[model samples]
Target chain A: MGQVVVVTSGKGGVGKTTTTANVGLALGMFGQRVCLIDTDIGLRNLDLALGLDERVVYDLIDVCSGVCRLQQALLRDKHIETVYLLPAAQTKAKTDITPEQMRTLLEQLKPSFDFILLDSPAGIEQGFQNAIAGADWAIVVTNPEPAAVRDADRVIGLLHGAGLTDVRLILNRLRTQRLDARSTGNGTAGLGEIEEVVDQLAVDLLGVVPEDERVVDSNLQKEPLVLHQQDRAGQAYREIARRMLGESIPLMELTPPKPFWRRLGLRFGHHARVERK
Target chain B: MGHRDPSLTRKWGQGGKRRAMAYLPSHIRVKGSRDGLTFYFDGNVAMEVWLAELQQLLQREHHLFQGPAVPVRICFGRVPLGTEEAAIRACFASHPNLIVHRVEASSTSITSRTGEKERTAPTLLWGPVRSGAEIQSDGALIVAGDVHSGARLVAKGTILVFGILRGMACAGSDGDIEAIIAAWELACPVVEIASRRKSFEKLSAGPTLVRLEGEELVTAPARHLKRGQGGREQPWAKWWS
Candidate 1:
C-alpha cells in the first residue's frame, strides 16, 4: 500500500507540472521506487519534462481504456532507471476516465512501488476530481501571486468538499528579495505577503521555490534543472525533497538581488552561487 | 519545435560531461538487476547525497541509461517516512527534465505506526474540550459535546464535531493540511491546518473558511460571501452584557 500523492493547482501556469517533474525526479534520486502519472489528459506534458515524449508508447488513457496494461503504458525515463511514467493521453478529454477507474489504477500501482504521484490538471472540474480520486494525499502547488493563492485556497476548499484533507502546499516561484521589508519596488510580494496568505489559508508549507530562468531554459532543453545538481532552483527542489523526507534541511538562503542589482547586475552572479558545493 | 535524437551531441560538451560523470560518493547503493537499477539508501542518510549520486550516474551513462526514471526505493524497514519525503518527491516531479519518483516505508507501517495510531477510535468523548484533549487521527473524532478554550482537535484526515467548537481545532494533521473543521457557527474556533494556525478567535462573528495559504492558516468568507468586505462583526460582541 504505497502512498498516492497528487500534485495539483487550481490555476494554470503556476508551475504545477514543473513542480511535479522536479519533485518526482528528486524523490527518485533519493532512492524511492517512484511512478508519476500525468492526469492532465489531452494537455499532457510530464513526459516532455522528463525528456520521454518520444518514447511514450502507451499512455494513461491507454491503461484506463484497457488498450494497454498499466505497466505497458508506463514510459521509462532514460536517466533514472527505477522511476516510471504513465503519461496522459494527448487525444483524450477530462471525462474519459472515471474517478473509480483512476482509483483502481492507483490501487494496482500501490503494491508494486513505494509512491505514486499524480500530476493533476488545473481547475476544480472533472479533471481535478479524477486526479484526486485515488490519491492518499495531495501537494497543492501555488505561486506567490494573490490570484494564485486565492485559487489555491479554492482548491483546498474543494479538497475538503471531497473529504480529502491530506493536502499540503508548495509555494512556487517565491521572490525572496521581496520579503525584505526594506525593498519597495518589486512586482512580487515578499515573505510577509506569503505568510499572510499561508496564515489565511491554514495549510502546512512544504517548500518555497524561487523564480529561476534556468528552470525555463532546462524545460526548453528537455532536462529538469533538478538533475543539473548545480542549479539553484534545482538545489531548492532537492532541498525540498530532503525536507519532505524528514531530514530537517534548512531553507536555501539565496535571496534575489534588489533592483540595484538589476541596474548593475553581473551575468554569472546567480550561476556562481549555485555552482558552489 | 524540432525533436532531435538527443543521441550523443554536445549535451553539455566535455566539461558538462565531466560534471555529470563520476561516482556520487559511492556510499549510496545502486543495485542493477535484470529489471532495472534500484537505488538503496539508508533511512538515516540525507536525500541530497542520493540525488547527487543519481545525477552523477545519469551524467556518466547519459547515453546508455535507459529503463525508466531511476526508481530510488528507500528501504526504511520499519521506520516511517514523513510528509516531507512525499513533498520532496512531488517537488522533484515538478522539475522540467527529471524523471525521479517516490515511495516510502511499507504501507502497513505508515498507516498503523503514525497516521492512524495517533488518536484511538473514540467511542464517546464527553463535554467541551477545556484545555487539552489533543484528539487527532485519520479516522473521524466525534465529540459528544462542545469544545472549550485551549482544547485541541487534530486529525490526520478529518475532524467532525457534533457540538460547537469554541476551542482550537486542527483538521488534517500530519501532511494533510487540506482538512476543514465545519461547525454550526465558527465563532472563534481557533483552527490550525496541518501545523499552521488560522484565526484563533471565533470571528466571534459568523461562518469562516480556514485553509492553507502558503505556510500559514487563513480564514475568510466562504464562497457564498462576497470579497473585500470585512467579515461580519462578532455578533456576540454587541450582546456581551
Candidate 2:
C-alpha cells in the first residue's frame, strides 16, 4: 500500500497547485512512482501546470463514475516516467463526486503507486472535505502574511478534527529580506519569523520555499521547478521530497546579509546555505 | 446499561407521532458506576408504568444494599420534559431507601442541570488552537498547547492553557466571577470572565492569571501556582475528580 498526502490551503492563491506539482515531481526524481490528483474540480490548474492539459480526455469524475478506467484517466509525463497526472474536470463542480467515491478511488490506486498527492481546492467546503477523505497525510502551504498563517491555522484545526493528525507545514513565498524586530513598533506581535508561524500552527516544519520569480515562470514554461537546477525554491521542494521519504535532513539556513548591505538596508547576494544530503 | 441516543426518544415522544417508538426497549433499567447510579426510563413507556417497574425492582433488590440510602439519578431517554420532571421527582420522593440526586432529560443536552454538574469534564486538547477555531466546554477547559490569536476558548468554570495564550479566553461564561483563566504567558487581545472583557496587547513578564475582581478583570503573576502541580491550588487527582 502507498501513502496518500493532500496539499491544501484554506485561502486561495497560496501555491497549493504549484506545491503539488513540484513536490510530486521531485518525488518522482527519487525513483518513486508518484501520482498527482487535482481535486480542484471546477477551477482546474494542475493539468496546465503539468503540461497535460491537452491530454486530459478523461478526468477524475470519469474515473470515479465508471465512465473510464483509472488508468485511462491518468496521463503519464513524457519526460519523467515515474510520475503520473490525474486531471480535474473544469466543467464539473466538486459536489459531483462524494467523499466515499474519492476514498474508493484512492484505495484502488494505493497498491500500484508509491505516493498520491491530492491538490485540494481553496476553501474548507465540499471540495476540501472530499479531497481529504482518503488522505493519510496533509501538507499545509502558507505564506508569511497574517491572513495566510491564520488560514493555515484553521486548516490545521480542521485536519486534526477530521482525524488527519499527521500534518506538516510548508512555508512558501518567504522573502529573503530580513526585517528588524524593533520596526514592528506597535504593541501587537508581528509574524515576521518562520519560527513564529511554525509555533502558531504547532506543526512540524517540512521545508521552506523562498520567494523566487523563476517559480512563477516555471508554470508558464510548463516545467516543474524541481527540474530547474540551482533555483532556491526548486532546492527547497527537493529537500521536502527527501524528508518525506524518511530522510534526516536539517532545514536550510537563512544566511545573513553583509554588514555594508545591512547598514544600507539593501538585500544583495543573500542565499540560504544548504548542505546537500 | 448501554448508552441510548437521546434523539431516538425525543422525536417520537415530543412529536407524539411515535412511529419508531415501538422499537425502543420497553423496560426500566439501572446502571451504577463511579459517577453515580442512574435509573433509565424509556420514552415509549408510560410514566406511571416506569415508576411502578422501578419500585418493584428496588423492592426485590433492597436486600443487596445493607448500607444507608444510596444517591441515585433519574434519566428520561426520549421524553421532551417541559414541566413534568417535578412530578416524576415528587413520585420518587416516597422511596425512602433512595435519595434523588438529579433528574436528567438527556445526558448530552446542555440545557439540563445534569450536563452542567456531572457531564462537564475538563476537555484536554493536544495541539495549539488556531485562529477562527473555537473550543467550548460546559464546565472547564484545558489546552495543552498555545492558543493563537482569533481563536476562542469558552468554559463555564476555569480555562487553563499549558502553553501561551495569544487569543481569547472566556471563563465562568454564566457570570461566575470566581472562574479564572490562566496561561504560561498571556498576551491575549481579548479575555472575558463572567460577561466582563479585557484586552492584553503584550505578554506579561511571567506566567499570568486573569480573573474578574469587583466588575473589572485583573491580571496577576501566577508563579505561585507553578506548572506540573496540576495547575491549580490543589492538584486535580483524577480526570473525573
Candidate 3:
C-alpha cells in the first residue's frame, strides 16, 4: 500500500500547493508512481501549478460523486511519466466530499501508486478535514514569521489530535539576506531562528526553502520548480524529497554574502586585533 | 416581556414579531445591564459559529467600546465544561479594552438562592494562546504559555503570563488602579493598567513587571520587587498608597 501524505498550513498563501506539486514531481523523478490530489475544492490551484489545467476532464469531486471513475480523472504529467494529477472541482463547494468518502477514495488509489500527496486548503474547516482524512503522514508548511509559526503549531496540535503523529515541519520563504541583516543588528525585528521555530512547534525539520524569485517564475510558467534543476528553490525541494525518501542529506547553508567593504573591514579588523593581542 | 422596548415594537410591527426574532442569530443574545453589556449563548449553535458571529458583532461596534473601562459579561445558557469557556473567551481576543466583568452559567442551579453576588474563579489557560485568540477573566487571570500577536488578555485584577507576552494586555480592567501585569518576557505592543497606557519600543528579554505609579504605568525588573514582602509592603505599594 502507498503512503498518503497531506501538505497543510492553517494560514493562507504559505505555499501548500507548490510544495505538494514539486515534492510529488521529485518523488516521481525517483521512479516512484506518485499521485497528487488537489483537495481545495472551490479554490483549485494545483492544476494550474502543475500546468495541467487544460488537460483536466474530471476532478476529485467527479470521482467521489461517481460521475466518473478514479482512473478517468487522473491526469498523467507530460514530463514525469510516473506522476499523476487529480484535480479539484472549481465549481463545487468544499463540503461536497465528506471525510469518509475521501478516505475510501484514497484507499482505492493506494494500490496503484507508490505515494499519494493531498494538497490541503487553508483554514481548519471542512476542506482541511477532508484533506487529512486518510493521510498516514502530514507535512505542515510555515514561514519564518510568528503568525505562520503559530498556525503551524495549531495544525500540529490538530494533526496529533486526529492520531496522525508523524508530522514534520517545512519552513518556506526564508529570506537569508534579511535574516543575516537582522542578526548583524542592521534590521529591526529578526525572522526568528530555525531552532526557535522547531522548539515552538515541537516537530522535526524536514527542509527549509529559501526565498527565491525563481519560484514566482516557475509559477508563472506553470512548471514544477524541480524540473528547472538550476534554481535554488528547486534544489531545496529536491533535497526535501530525498529527505522524505529517508535519505540523510545535509541541509543547505543559506547565508547571504556580505558587501566587499564589510568583508575587507572584518579582515583588517581581525589583523589589527591579532597584532594588539 | 414586561421590559420590552417600545421602539422594537414600532420597528417590528405587532404581527411581524416572529419575523424580527428570526432575523437575529438564535444562538446569541446581547443585552445591556448595570455591570455592562452581557452576551448570552444559548448553546443551540456550534461553538465556531457562535464565535464567528460574536467576533463580527464586536468588530462592527468596536468604535463604541474602544476604551479599557467597558465592562462586558459573558453568560452561558449552560455551564461550559473543559475548554468550552476558553473557546468562548477567544472570540473577544482582539478587543483589548473590552473588560470581561463576569463569565457564568445562567442555569438556575448554579445561582444561589440568597441572591448574593456570584464569584468566579480565575481562568487558568494551559496552552500557548495563538494569534487571534483571547482570554478574559472577571477576576485574576494566569496563562501557562506564550501569547502571540493579535491575541490579548484582559483581567479585572492581575494578569500574569508564565511565558512571553507579545500581544496586547490590559490589567485592572474594571478600573482597579492597583492591578499589575507581569510576564516572563515583556514584548507587547500595547500594555494598559487601568487608564494608563504605554507602548514599549524595545521589549525586555528577562522577566518584567508593569504596574501603575502615580497614574503612570511603569516597568521594572521583577527581581527587584523585594522578596519576602507581601501585600502592600512590596515596592509597587506606592501606587496604592
Candidate 4:
C-alpha cells in the first residue's frame, strides 16, 4: 500500500500547491510512482501549476461521482513518466465529494502508486477535512511571518485532531538576507525567526525553501521547480523529498555570506573587532 | 392648588388609587420608604416602555419631589441588562438628581443573600481546538490543549486554557464583564468580553490573562496577577492561597 500525504496550510499563498507539485515530482523522479491530487475543487490550480491544464479532461469529482473511471480521470505527466495529475473540478464546490468518497478514492489508487500527494485547499472547512481523510502523513507549509506561522500552527493542531499525528513543517519563502539582517540588528522588521516558528508550531522540520525568484519564473513558465535541476528552491524540495524517504540530508545553510570586513575579522580570530562602538 | 377640597379628596380616596393601580403594567412598580424611593421593574418589559413610564412618572411629580434629588435604587427583577445596559443609564440622563445608588437584578440579589452561588460547570475539552472548530459554553470553559487560529471559544463566564491560545476567545458571553480569559500562551488576534473586543498584533511569551479593566480590555502577564500588585490581594490568587 502506498503512503498518502496531504500538503495543507490554513493560510493561503503559503506555497502549498507548489510544494505538493515539487515534492510529488521529486518522488516520481526517484523511480517511485506518484499521483498528485488537487482537492481544492472550485479553485483548481494544480493542473495549471503542473503545465498540464490543456490535457485535463476529467477530474477528482468525475472519478468520485462515478462519471468517469479512476484511470480516465488520471492525467499522466508528459515530462515525468511516473508522475500523474488528478486535477480538481473547477465548476464543482468542495462539498461535491464527501469524506467517505475521498477515502474510497485514495484506497483504490493506493495499490498502484508509490506515493499519493493531496494538495489541500486553504481553510479548515469541508475541503480540508476531505483532503486529509485518507492521508497517512501531513506536511503543513508555512512562511516565517506571524500570520502564516499562526495559521500553520492551526493546521498542525487540526491534523493532530484528525488523528494524523505524523506531521512535519515546511518553512517556505524564507528570505535569508532579511533574516540575517534582522538577527544582526540591522533590520527593523521583526519577522518570526525559524526557531520561534518551530517552537510555536511544535512540529518536526521537513525543510526550508529560501526566497527564490526562480520559483515565480518557473510558475510563469508552467514548469515544476524540481525539474529545473539548478534552482535553489528546487534543490530544497529535492532535499525534503530525500528526508521524507528517510535519508538524513543536512539542511542547507540559509544565512547569506557576511561582509568582507566581518569575514576577515572572523578569519583572523578577532571577533571583537567586528563589534561597533 | 394646595387649598383643601374635601369633596375632591373623598372622590380620590386611597382605595380609589389602589383600584386604579390595577390598570397599570406590573413592570412599573414604585415604593416609598423613609430611606428614599425604589423603582422595580420586571425585566421582561420592553426597555422603551419601561423608560417611557419612568420618564412620565418623574415629569408628573417633578414639582412634588423637587426639594432634593432623592437616591433611587432601580431593580430589574431577572433582566441581565447585557449590552442594553447603556440604554438604562440613558433613561436617567435628564434626572441628574435621581442618584442611581445601585442597579442590580433581583435574582442575583436573592442568590447572593442566600449564599447560594450559581454554579455553571465548565465544559472541559481534552484536545486541541482546531481551526474552524467553534466551541460554545453556557458557563465557564476549560481547554486542556491549544486553541488554534480560526477556532473560537465562547463562554458565558470565564475561559481557562492550559495550552497556547492562537484563536479567538470570548468570555463574559452573558454580560458579566468581570469574566476573564487566561491561557498558557496568548497569541490570538482577538479576545472579547461581553461584546468588547481587543485585537492583539503580538503577545509576549508565556501565560497571560485578559480581562476588562475599566472600559478597555487589558492583558497582563499571569504571574503578575498571582503576586498581587500594590499590596492588594488578587482575587484570582485567593483560590490558590
TM-score: which candidate is best? 2
Interface RMSD of 3: 3.3
Model 1 residue B231 CA deviation (Å) reads: 23
Q: Chain B vs. true chain B: TM-score for each candidate?
A: 0.36, 0.46, 0.46, 0.49
Candidate 3 per-residue lDDT, tens place, B1-241, comes to: 3333445444434567553543354456665544467676765457777677676567655676677576887767577765777776676767877777667775422221112134445678876765656678987788998876667788987788998888789998899776788889998888999968999898898989888877788888877444302222232322211
Please give the lDDT score at residue A138 for candidate 1. 83
**Reference-based TM-score of each model:** 0.51, 0.67, 0.62, 0.65
List ranges where model 3 is wrong by over 4 Å.
A145-166, A179-202, A256-277, B1-127, B133-144, B152-159, B168-179, B191-202, B212-218, B226-231, B234-241
Kindly give the stretch of ten consecutive residues in candidate 3 chain A with the minimal lDDT sum: A182-191
Which candidate do you rate higher for DockQ, 2 or 4? 2
Q: Candidate 1: how large is its RMSD?
A: 29.9
lDDT per residue for candidate 4 within B68-99, as digits (tens), equals 77887666767556654566667666677777
Candidate 1 local lDDT, B1-241, one digit each (tens): 1222244334434666443233233433444433334334444446665556545445554554444464444333245356536644554453334344435453221211123234445334654443334665554455766554445777664454555566677776676644555554565545766777765632534545565655876656444223211333111111110
Interface RMSD of 4: 2.6
What do the candidate models score in CA lDDT, each in turn? Answer: 0.66, 0.78, 0.80, 0.80
lDDT tens string, model 2, A107-132? 99999999999999999999999999
* Deviating ranges (above 4 Å) for candidate 4: A65-68, A90-95, A124-126, A157-161, A184-192, A257-266, A270-272, B1-131, B136-150, B161-166, B172-179, B183-241
| Residue A103 lDDT in candidate 4 | 92
Residue runs of model 2 more than 4 Å from their true location after superposition:
A179-192, A256-277, B1-125, B201-205, B223-241
Q: If the candidates were sorted by their TM-score against the true structure, best first, what order would they fall in?
A: 2, 4, 3, 1
Considering DockQ, which of the candidate structures 1 and 2 is the better prediction for this target? 2
Candidate 2: clashing pairs of residues: B9-B78
Error of 1 at A123 (Å): 0.9
How far off is model 2, as Cα RMSD?
A: 14.8
